[model samples]
Target: MGLNGSIPPDIGNLSFLVSLDLSWNRLHGGLPKDICIHNKLPRVKELQLSFNDLEGEIPLGLGECQQLEILDLLYNNFGGHVPREIGNITRLTKLDLHWNNLSGTIPKEIGHLSNLEFMDLGSNKLRIHPKRSREQSYTKTQGNLIQSQRENCVLFVFTF
Candidate 1:
């Protein structure tokens, strides 16, 4: 179905929604402030809203989606910095916010997402501060090793 204008605030009513794909549409206006109100979509795993005409800041309440695993909002007209509360979603594994007009420092809280494996923050005007000199160097060397091992394990599982 073709959805134009603003996304309805009642969208959160889809309690059983596992994935919501509204990409490449003409949907305009700001996202509802309480898009994820009532803790709806407790089982939602993926939400794709890329390449739309939507504007304004991303709803911070999205952090309440505990079961959210993938959130793609690329190529939109979204502005403002990404909400730091996004780190509260511990189950997030993949987050893509590339090619948008978003600006400002990427929240340090993002580092707390231990389960985040695929993060594409490219092409945005976000400033990412490196960890302290010593910590940065240590994580670079040690973290790379750990990340490589994890990637290998993921690849192995996928291949099998």
Candidate 2:
């Protein structure tokens, strides 16, 4: 069902929550700061809140969710840099933050997500400004794949 209101902070009390999909809804307001507070979502595997009217930075506490595998926050109004804390969730595989108002360089910590399979940071205010040594390392293997095709892609880089 599609809801059209803010999520209750008490909802985070569901310590047993395994998977939550709140996509394509009319929900507004920022997510609860305690949604994953204190490692609350120990069993959570997937959390999809895409295509909604939600705004604000992703809750910093989400990094405590050690079991998270898929996190989809696409097409929202979220702003600010991707949280470095998220890189602490070693179990993450798919992370989607596309089509938001985020800015700043992609965090180097994201490169540490060894399990990440898919990630999309396109269509936002984000930029890519890599240091020379890092660019050279990637260019050697990836062949400078990022062309100056789009204005927002001025410093984009790809790593396999």
Please, what are the lDDT tens digits per residue for candidate 2 over residues 76-120?
Answer: 999887887888888887788888888886666665566666667
Task: Tell me the whole-model lDDT of each prediction, alpha carbons only.
Answer: 0.71, 0.74
User: Residue 74 lDDT in model 1?
Assistant: 82
Residue 94 in model 2: lDDT: 78
Error of 1 at 142 (Å): 17
**Tens-digit lDDT string for candidate 1 (29-83):** 8778786756877788898988888889998988888899888888888899989
Looking at model 2, which ten-residue stretch has the lowest summed lDDT?
132-141
Candidate 2 stretches with Cα past 4 Å from truth are 132-160
Clashing pairs in 2: none
* Model 1: pairs clashing at backbone N, Cα or C within 3 Å: none
